[model samples]
Target chain A: MKYKDYYKILGVEKSASADDIKKAYRKLAHKYHPDVSKEADAEAQFKEVGEAYETLKNPEKRAAYDQLGSFQPGQDFRPPPDWGGQFGAGQHFSEDADFSDFLHGLMGGRFSQKHGGATMPIPGEDFEVAARITLEQAASGSEIEIKLSVHEPDAQGFPRRVPCSIKARIAKGATQGQRLRVPGKGGKGLNGGRDGDLYLKIELAPHRLYRVQDHDLYVDLPLAPWEAVLGATVEVPTLSGRVRLKVPPGTQAGQQLRLAHRGLPKPHKGEGDLYAIAQIVVPAKVSERESALYQQLAEGSDFKPRSHFDLEVADEH
Target chain B: MNIEISEAVWLDRAGVISMSELAQLSGLSEAILLQLIEYEVLPPAASAAGGPTFTGDCLVTARMACRLQSDFELDAAGLALVLSLLDRIRGLEAEVRGLQAQAPRRPHKA
Candidate 1:
């Protein structure tokens, strides 16, 4: 699998202000809205753009993505074995509408709440629902089928998706609380009025993979003390998958390794990134040989580990 | 098992009608609009300064006209007359709404 960049899809710079990113997405959404668009791929492109905007617009998810690298769209993406730690029984996004397998493979299958058209239009009859998908889908894009008891406009010229299925292409880089509109799939009209569309409220689920912060992805990359101390090529996990990481020599714990174009793929153009924080783990106790080695290291090195420490004088003047 | 498939005209995203400012999107064509004007059914595109230039509200008008032409078998002249009547009726309805609002508010099925 490959990670996709959310920023590129929305057409913004890595350091683009939040406001700029949002503006870009809104412009694209309006342009690609299926109801008005006549292009062959308008609906798909609109959804893709929306998803990309969703990811980059959020500060938390964006940050988590930044850890992997500069996100690219459609690049081979795969998360490491320990990507999400454990994808247990928990639904994050709603995929009430039908989505694509590409999205499923990329996102790891998140489902969203499906909604339908409004009826009983004396007034105030509105329909609303939600969808839950994984962070992967937000980054890589997917297709989903939202099954709702909708009234599709038939040849007779009435409202219709009734008992209809709307196929939604969940864009890569979609963020939590993002709302997408499935035109003509909204609430029923009043007195033969136009049907209100389906509004999708996006919600993200928590995973053990990494903590998201804006466009950067942060994951605790476990490293042996020796590996951290001596530069080594470590197999680090990203949202896309695992890649050989270069740990600089004498690397300290909590140091982050940045790999470009390795984060969430963008819907269209820009990329999000990922970060790997080197976390060193040690056993509670070491064998005698290990202890002797440490002792030798202590004897040979004059470097004071706590030299920066300051102690209060016994008698303060 | 082998299967038989049929082909049909697929209209998906529609198309883009880029204007100097906002793009007018639609699946219909300019010829349709010309026919509409020739019949004198609806108003022409008025590009008020700092407003949508080419065709803004024309999308809805065009859709209605297209539906009338394709489904009702209404020729361009017939559509123009019918749509003109419909627009007049709509105006009357709006005036009625205004008058009703002055009288009282009631929960009525439109």
Candidate 2:
């Protein structure tokens, strides 16, 4: 096994006082705490620091570890062959601390205890994973499956993997970033303790046709120029199905029309409204007859499209 | 392959859980949890004749406090401050997201 210099990990000297060690550990732990730190590997770094402090904080463990003299971090080293039976079965570190094999070897298998008689209870650590779903799935309830790699302690305290697949129910109107908790589905507890719960974070995949803002859904509604000028009833697509929406007379581009109760489902309430924004489209190509009709209308009409530009210039001047 | 259907109970959906269940799920002692509640690190949602009840969101908060206590040796006051600050940050982030969602589309840069 590679030697791990606990003093080096804590950035302290081997002869440093216990107070100095404690101060350094506190500073590093606070800096690297996963919830507070924005570092990508803050969690891993925090665990490493915790492991280092676990050994250095205790005098007995420190003395035992210091016996392997002058060994550097990452150097090949092994504990003395006669060192296996000295430690007792009592656990010192926290339940979530999955100590390295080096520490386990030093303690003659730390998790190994006398299971034939009464055993100490240690609850397993909770685990989390994201479950991604489509927008339609978020609107309507669906079932999802996720795989978790659980660590099971053997009869001798050696760790082994047990792959578990869980099928979960997603309730209707579940929004992005919502967490669904599953009870007693995490890592196995030690000595018959209860298993930890699993937290599934919901992630809504982006949709091409719609944009979601909370429960409200937005879609671009393209219409012909004549249809925008004259009132028309048009069909719009919603999560549930298609519904006919009325376009009021003289509807302008960029104007949004609300279709009540046609958006995503809300918890303990009716569905939210969908906003369909108007986009007027003009024909790029015209036949001779259509061109003549358009020319006649353009000559006969008194409408001025640039009337707003004159007002804007006068305001600026 | 056999498909195992999990009889999952969504904590957020349930909204409230008993104190004993919270303790069991968070792996914290009842006394320490009571201390946390007393310090306002986590507030209970309701109270019964037996004991106080907490929201499912408190499960995450209690578990986090437990870990921070173990890793950094923080006291109840420290846990309370940290948890409150974290909650504020989450609120701000959600507000920012809502505002962004409401904003109109910007013109494409040339």
Interface RMSD of each: 22.7, 4.8
Q: Tell me how candidate 2 scores on lDDT.
A: 0.75
Deviating ranges (above 4 Å) for candidate 2: A1-32, A62-85, A88-110, A114-118, A220-235, A247-256, A267-270, A277-317, B35-41, B105-110
For lDDT, the strongest prediction is 2
The share of true interface contacts that also appear in candidate 1 amounts to 0.00
Interface RMSD of 1: 22.7
Candidate 2, residue A92: how far the Cα is off, in Å: 20
Local distance difference test scores for all models: 0.54, 0.75
Put down candidate 2 lDDT per residue, A166-190, tens digits, no spaces. 7888778777677678777776677
lDDT of 1 by residue, A26-45 (tens): 67765775533557887679
